[model samples]
Target: MNAIGIDELRGLAMLPPTASGHSPFAEPCLLLRLGGTAERRLADWLRQLPCPVIGIGEADAPLAASCDVVVQNEQEAQPLLAGVRRSPVAATVLVQLLRASESLPVADALTMESLAYATLQGGAEFRRWLEGRPAPPVPPAETGPAVLLAREADTLRLTLNRPARRNSMSVEMRDALVEALQLALADDDIRRVRIDGAGKCFSTGGELDEFGTAPDPATAHAVRSLTVPGRLLAACADRAEARVHGACIGSGIEFPAFAGRIVAAPDAWFQLPELQFGLIPGAGGCVSLPRRIGRQRTACMVLGGKRIDARTAKDWGLVDAIESSR
Candidate 1:
């Protein structure tokens, strides 16, 4: 809960040396408040800080890139970030990965995220979540295809068709999406690709029944390498547009984030609840989202476990426009 001023931070660097190389930021997090000029001057140094530096005061676009997360008021952030501060290693590593992923190719970035996610899956926090989770009942089998694909003139249309289950991203859906995306990639005649869902909600995230079913963390990573629709979506992003409505959780938001343009219906709401499962956004979100919104806001959303409505998504540049749901 304690915060350090820029002047005080500079002063500590001037302190007498110790044989053990004492670090002033012994706490799990470093809450920092600084004038605009001070932050800009120490930007490079702050980026290399040993602990997560949470900026206090109004959001500064430039300074946000240097910190793990920022809050207009530190008091407000204390409770919001309690989980992340408690699990400092995961949060720290997530932010570090987000920072490094921006310049990497989408495939490489996703690979990095999967490796980190697998590491966390083996950690105690994730194991605790899995232990606490009740076994899910078998969902009724739907009769039709998980996705619908149609080629219309020069445009390709893809829809998430499992409305009865809120279009949850099951393994079937993942494979279907990969096939649809692959079709577009192979056909030079397809100029525009439009993606949307068939029912009220675009997607409610991954299917609950599928959670924790992976044999092991390593196997999970292996499966994700082949099945992630986000990477395919990114490859075709140059000509892709997505229309999302209602609950856009987890894979819902992560997939659309790879599109060139995203339009949200008034009812759309977004959340990333994967941290509750003791994992980060393994669906290419750590890469896709940070490139759209800054790493700070993305970290806040994932770590804070908050819902962001459509308006907030637009303001944050997550979506290109707001429109009636298709």
Candidate 2:
């Protein structure tokens, strides 16, 4: 890995995209250390590069967008840089694809993510991880509703009901969530939809057992496009309020993020851990979170598998505010 200043980066950007075997874009990651402010226009050029950009210090507002992710100093960046080196293809390709989809429509962005995630799923990295971990367990049929719905006069309250599973987003849960959100979309009479969960955590993530069961990458992509509850939650975003508690992870945070307002309990923490399994945020997180916080911060979480506690989440605009424990 190499670190470059603003002036050198501008010069490097002038090179043609296919400028021989020495193209800067061919590297796994690059550290950008800007002593002062940078030209906002440079962000456009930076995004076009296929490599991951790590903003080092004093990134300033304008230059922050150009960084795929950032750290205040070099010491904090070692693990991230090492991760990029270990899985260079996933690190570089995932951010490149994420930046490309940042400005797209919600549905289109999700479809792009689904396709990319599926591609990664069938790749060597995911296979490598899968071979090492225990095979995901299969659970019996749901004996109860995954989501509990109750009408409170003008408001409809939806609760994630799978405490035993820590509210893992099973197929039943996704279907139930979509149907509930659709009601909000169809009826003007429903003034508000309050969504929360019933367990120690909102949801851990997607059902693990189902991870390797999809017949093929294409089929998985198609299924994700059809059943993604995040898209439906986005459709009713205006009327939705997600009150989350405990762990808001993977689909846990991915689903709630689409809500117009998200209030977090004191213990709430957010994370996106799909990358460890060589998958990207297949759940609309790439689209929704970047829209909420910004492209760089969202990339930081997904790429680094970092956790954001409630206070940090609020400060970063990942959540609307932190609420009292009550």
Candidate 3:
């Protein structure tokens, strides 16, 4: 929660490193603004800092690489700081977030470790709040399909059909996804499974009103583990591709992270807002996202509730490619 000015940051870098090879302020999250000549000159020292540093303004490649987060403007830094302060394990969370900024090779085993850590350290109040909300009203069967399934040669296309709701992942949508994926798994002729959303967005995340509908946490955990579309996508990752556009939020981005190929439109943006709601990503994001971009970046996204643009997502290895929206 400490906001250090650029001058102070520069001074700290010049001081002697501790026996542990970390700066004196290394234990606390440091926030600062850097640009122009100063940023370039201090790039090496900035990279060597052992603490989490949130930088505002344009940074050279070396400095940018060293920064735990680089926001284009000062306003964006506020929410990230707020998110960190709200967490019970702020230092640990910040360290994880900072580690994500580092260049690390992706490994399945490492991703699993990240998932375990996320689940174990997630806020209990967030869980209780999410599970205490009112259940959502059921959509009528006559409302047409929440998910539309079709075939085109070897490819099976699944479109989220509820444009009015921005294709929120309602119960009906989840069921439809499960069924379509199950069919795709059984059919030998279905060589590819392509997922897309109708209207403006890929999705606005899970329907908020539906939180806490499950009778108990145990049942909810079972459903999330055994029947969520994220699991289905993970099972057939090699054959699955998600063409995402617009705002891909919460479950929107989490589910697609499990796919082998994610083709995002130029205008697409990704975000994880679950932490703002006082909960971790409940829709398999902790597992799927860390697997794609490494746990550190995943931690940054979740803990900071930051919006990552399509280009950033591609650069971080979250999406395979960026293409025009169809």
Candidate 3 C-alpha lDDT tens digits along 1-326:
44555567667767642322343234445566664345655656655555456777664533555566777776777776677555534334434433542344323323433443344334464566556666656643336799999999999999998887888998889999999999988889999999999989999898877765666555565565545787777778899999999999999998888889999999999998876555667576766786788654776787688798999999999999999955
Q: List where candidate 3 sits over 4 angstroms from the true fold.
A: 2-78, 89-124, 127-142
lDDT of 1 by residue, 30-103 (tens): 67774545544557666655555677876754455577788878776785457565565666667667767868
Whole-model lDDT per candidate: 0.81, 0.81, 0.71
Each candidate structure's TM-score, on Cα atoms with residue i matched to residue i, is: 0.90, 0.91, 0.68
What is the lDDT, from 0 to 100, of the residue 230 in candidate 2? 92
Which portions of model 2 show Cα errors greater than 4 Å?
18-26, 36-44, 137-142
lDDT tens string, model 2, 132-158?
A: 898666664456788999998889999
Task: Report the CA-based lDDT of candidate 3 relative to the real structure.
Answer: 0.71
Judge candidate 1 at residue 111 and give its lDDT: 96
Poorest lDDT segment (10 consecutive residues) of candidate 3: 17-26
Off by over 4 Å in 1: 11-26, 36-42, 61-64
lDDT of 3 at 101: 29
